[model samples]
Target: MMMAVGVAERTGLLETAVKATIARAPARLLPYVVAFVACQGHVMSDIAILVIPPLAALAFKAAGRNPVAGLVGAFACVCAGYSAGFTVGALDALYAGITEKVAAALPMGQEAPTHLLVNYFFTASASVVLALIGGFLTARVLEPRLPEPTGDGSSGDEESPTTEISKEQRRGLLLSAAAVGVYTAVVLVVWLLPGSPLRGEGGALIPSPVLSGIVPLLFGAFVIAGVVYGVAARTVTHKNDVPKMMGESITSMSGYIVLILVIAQFIAVFNWSNVGTLLAVKCAALLESAGLTGFLALVLFVLVVTLLNMLISSGSALWSLMAPVFVPTFMLIGMSPALTLAAFRIADSATQMITPLNPYLFLSLALMRRYEPGAQLGTLMSRLAIYVVPFLVAWLAVLGIFYAFDLPLGPGAGIEMP
Candidate 1:
């Protein structure tokens, strides 16, 4: 995750490409641009919130629209869409890793193999759903409620350059695409070809190299694409530039690293205490005794997670703590680990926009204040709650429907365990 963001920042590939894409878009397509920026949150949620909001604000300003609507809409989408992404990335790998470790503690014959793509299908669907919801809310709700800008839509800068894509950037983007295409082709051949080494024993896809090794593949692909783009665009002049950019990227993520370490220690202590397991067993037994199994149990679980998200902002940390208890319990109650994870993701994402504890909330507020000097955190929260509330209801409804249908959460992953 750090490496990917570092490469993009160092090469200026993301910013340049995004600006270029926005520049070519018609005014009517500005809402789509906001949704697109929100979807990028799937890459790295915190980073996306920081990077995309300002750009979205600029895009709204350039279109002579309400900058507040653009900024808040982008922020809301990033928060709500954090759990859904088009491609598998670090978050998917991290969740799978935690699930694997925790599942090992389940009673011997009950444990299931934890694949990285366990929630891929559901999340992919969620990405599209949330994007459309975000676009609608931005245009219909947020924009209408926002007061018109008193000044020219610029954020204190009257002389911002026009959004344009240069020939060099175009060539660079094409070269990057070509690099990704070649790499993807190689991966497909290795995994899909008969008797290929990437496939598991008996040529199975599950528990195969492709499923287990997605994170490293993502890192390599992003680095390769960034390097190719950088060279073609003249962003990288010498051999030393690559490492320099990587180092800078790591430096920028120091705060996140510290947070991870603290959370890691907390998880370790929680596990050693055995309290999470005890709680899970008791809760599962209670729910079962109370006839709260199946869809009702799942709904209750989602609501619990949603409330927890208000106080705890870190998804990985919260999952590390909760999965130990919830995964096994849910399995015992007839739900699959993948379904449990899907529910967690929906709940976590739905509440992020309204959570005051989220680090991005502070950053977003700061950004908002720059545009509207009188912007207060409370006021912003209330406004964003409009989007968050409906998203929560709609998302829970989606989850309930998914549960009622007994749909597959991913390839070979059903809602219930046999």
Candidate 2:
């Protein structure tokens, strides 16, 4: 239905509409082996978020000469979407342990906003670095050498510049720039600018200057930018069309929304059950008896978190279960909870994109198949590894060095937050 509508909208063809509707074809059409392999339940992250990636990828796919740009663009969108941090999605779980530990009783869960900078500054920066490197590798290395048409939507031999495509690029870039600029400025004020609105009342304000604002800022930015870009890109033309595009975006997101809602509820329920707090307490107590140095302890904590990620896909759940223990425990060791959490986060995040259990990975693979049908999990992983590997190492190194120096992750954000 979606592919069909998109094809009709693009080609203005009615007869081909029925055939065009199915892109990769539904799971029912997959070969028995593929279906069996895909059923492993590894992909558990909230998938509704995929809407953002495709929206961002739409222009790139239309304008780029190769699959590399399109893939990078999609990842960019995913990172930005992750920046939102609401929806009790994968990210929320990751930071919940730290966030709630730092600032108790988070009124903001999935529906409300959280400060993205305080909790997610490191993640955001890592995301940008990864995106740039991925884009470069795609454009310079893969685009020029990629093989002929093979994927579901692969049109290697039939490339052409369309006015619509040009228009979308112009619109998307403009909207993306404006949105990112606004978001950056907000972070600057809260973290860099003195007397920023969110600056805590005084010293006791637990990482006073930098409050939780980045995620909401990002969410607002992307939602607005997506709408504006849709109109400016002519993907949507009329004022009325704006609503329709949003409607279309939301309509396409029913499945993901449902999943995230459950995820959110599960998070709240898990917290209410006090399971997370108990687990954190027990772990922290056990670790305390070890007498490791602050840095060594943090390093081990991060490794543990990374391994935990393989078993549990929910970042929020994991965090909720970890922060109470790690943060206070680290604080006792003369380390900041924020820093401790940040270190763990760096380790936890770099593996998500590569994990087989991540549902979004499958979506990415599906999209990749559109450009190269024969592209399998291993092939995509190999291609992604080149950039992702560098990113992981660079990011972890920067984070470790940053925490060791007791640098602020952002304004009012600091090495220590009781």
Worst 10 residues of 2 by lDDT: 33-42
Model 2, 1-418: lDDT tens per residue? 2222222223222111111221222322212111111111111133323432332233334433453344533453242223322122234433543454333422222222224345455554554454454445555655456565444354356552221325454545556558657876776655655555555565234444344543454445444545555555555556665446446645665774676566556556646776645655566566667767556777687778877877776565566555545654555445555566667655565556666877777777776676667778887666545544554565566666667787666444566543
- On TM-score, the candidate that comes out on top is 1
List ranges where model 2 is wrong by over 4 Å.
1-98, 101-114, 128-152, 155-282, 370-372, 385-389
Q: How far is candidate 1 from the true structure (C-alpha RMSD, Å)?
A: 2.7
- Candidates in order, TM-scores: namely 0.90, 0.58
Top model number, lDDT: 1
Could you give the C-alpha RMSD of every candidate to the true structure, in order shown? 2.7, 10.7
lDDT of 1 by residue, 155-230 (tens): 4544543456678878998899899999999998888999988898799976688866776777888898889989
